[model samples]
Target: MNTPAHLLMGAAVFGRPAQTKILLAAFFGAVLPDLSLYVMAGTSLLILGISPQRVFNELYFSDAWQTVFAIDNSFILWGILCLVAIWWRRPWAVALTGAALLHLCLDFPLHHDDGRPHFWPMSNWVFESPVSYWDSAQGANWVAPIELVMALACGVVLLVRRVPIWAVPLTLVLMAAEIWIVRQWLFFFTNS
Candidate 1:
């Protein structure tokens, strides 16, 4: 699933606390796994003085980098973080970690052969589901439109529930941006 879908689903599932901090934590948690891309790109730009195009070209296309980032974003690490949060009695941390786990759960079934190593560090295992959320060649052409509809519905739910004024619109915009980027830039660059 896309980040916005994960965020909205997390919020819908765990929004009962109705606390701003908790909601924000959930939002961040949904996106935390994907931060490896930003971290790598930022480091490449700042530390190595690499151009953005080269960074994207290398990192997004390299199998080794993909494996490394997959391990970095694995479920085992997030699960351990959640366990630690519970042990430390940090409610917000627990909420954040729980939402991250939820994101992984959603992703587990949506990825194709190039799936995350969800059990990395413990084991280099990937589920490699037949369906992919973004790859049209991997039976995801139908999923994109359905996911957009679901995201819109989630946005309406958030608006009706009186979530922060910016939440729904921001979610929608982010969702649209992700769809656009995947369809226009990422697919074109990677596939061609």
Candidate 2:
């Protein structure tokens, strides 16, 4: 799933209208899994001046990068943290780790060739689902639109739950971004 979709889903699932801290925690947890990718890829594209093809095709699937992905995308680690948070009776912590776990859960079945080692230390196995959210050849033409709709529905859920006024325009902006991203995936990626 796109990062924006994850953010909206996290906010809807774990965020509270008045609890800024919890909402922020949910947002952080949602993005944390993808943060390393952004940082590494951004540095490669901008600072290191790497071509998009090499950066995504080669570096993205490298052992070192996959290792980092394993730790962040690990269901075991996030599940442990979630349990610890629940034991400690920390709602914010629970929301944080719980949302992260949720992110991994959602990502698990949506990824095809790009699947991560979600089980990690317990197992190095990567479950390559039959569908992918971004890969056109992997049913993304249907999957991506459904993802966009679900993400927008999550935004509506946030609104119905009486989220802050700022969330209204934020949702709109995110919707726009998701649309643009989908268009890019459908057109640019499919053509390539």
Candidate 3:
């Protein structure tokens, strides 16, 4: 799933009492895994003065970079965070970690050969599903529409729950925009 979809799901699951901090934590949790890409891209841009597209090309094709950043999306990190939450008895941390885990769970069945190293640190294993969230050739063309509907449904739930009036619309717009951007990026990456 894309970041906005993950954020919407996190909000639907954890956004309650309309507390800003809690919602923010949930958003961050959903976004944390993808931060590895941001960090790698940002550093490459700064140090190498490369265009964003070039940086993306390198990251997408580089096995070494994938291995290095894979830890960010690993179940090992989730487990460690859960253990920390348990040890500290921090409900907020637990909620954040749970949101991240939800992100991982949603991603698990949607990735093909380029699946995440979900069991990293303990083992280098990736459960390559036949369907991919972004790859149309891998059956994501059908799945994409379903995900959009699910995200819209989640937005409705947020609205019904009386979340900030702008939240639902903003989430929907961001999801749509992200979907467009990612598809374009994928097209360029694949055809270039």
Candidate 4:
């Protein structure tokens, strides 16, 4: 799933309209899993002058990078945090961990070759699902559309709940970004 979709889903699931802190936590948790990827890839591409092919194809799967991914995408760690938050009776923490867990759960099956070791410390195993959100060879043609629809549905959920008026434009922009990315991927697949 795209990061923007995760953000929308997280907000819809764990955020309360009037609670800015909880909403921010939801957004942070949603993006946390993918944050490392962005930072690492961005640095490599921008600072190191690396080619996109090398940055994505080679560095992305490097052991060091995968190890970092394992920790962030770890189900055990997030579950422990969630439990701790519940025990401590911290609503914001609960929202954060819950959003993170939701992000991992949604990402669990949508990844094919690029699957992360979600079950981290417990195991370094990555589940390569039959469907990928972006890979055309792995049913992304159908899967991506469903994902987009779900993301939009999540947006509706947020709107219906009456989030701030400012959020409407942000949500629209995110949806548009998702649409553009999916279209780009589909075009690349068809052209290739």
Q: Write the per-residue lDDT of candidate 4 for residues 32-54, one digit (tens) a residue.
A: 89999999999999999999999
RMSD of each: 3.7, 1.5, 3.3, 1.4
Q: For each candidate, how many residue pairs have backbone atoms clashing (under 3 Å)?
A: 0, 0, 0, 0
Q: TM-scores of all models?
A: 0.75, 0.94, 0.80, 0.95
List the candidate 2 regions with Cα displacement exceeding 4 Å: none
Q: For residues 1-192, what per-residue lDDT tens digits would candidate 2 score against the true structure?
A: 999899889888988643778877887898888999999999999999999999989999999999999999999999999999999988888888988988998999999999899998899899999999999899999999999999989888877877677777776787778888988888887835
Q: What order do candidates take by TM-score, descending?
A: 4, 2, 3, 1
Q: Which stretches of candidate 1 lie over 4 Å from their true place?
A: 42-71, 86-89, 166-169, 178-192
Q: Rate the local accuracy (lDDT) of all candidates.
A: 0.73, 0.88, 0.75, 0.88
Candidate 2: residue 164 lDDT (0-100): 70
Which candidate tops lDDT?
A: 2
TM-score of 4: 0.95
Pairs in steric clash, model 1: none
Superposed by TM-score, candidate 4 places the C-alpha of residue 41 at a distance from the truth, in angstroms, of 0.4
Candidate with better lDDT, 3 vs 4: 4
**lDDT (10s digit) by residue, model 3, range 103-148:** 8889989988767788888877778899887777787767776887
Position 59, candidate 2: lDDT:
97
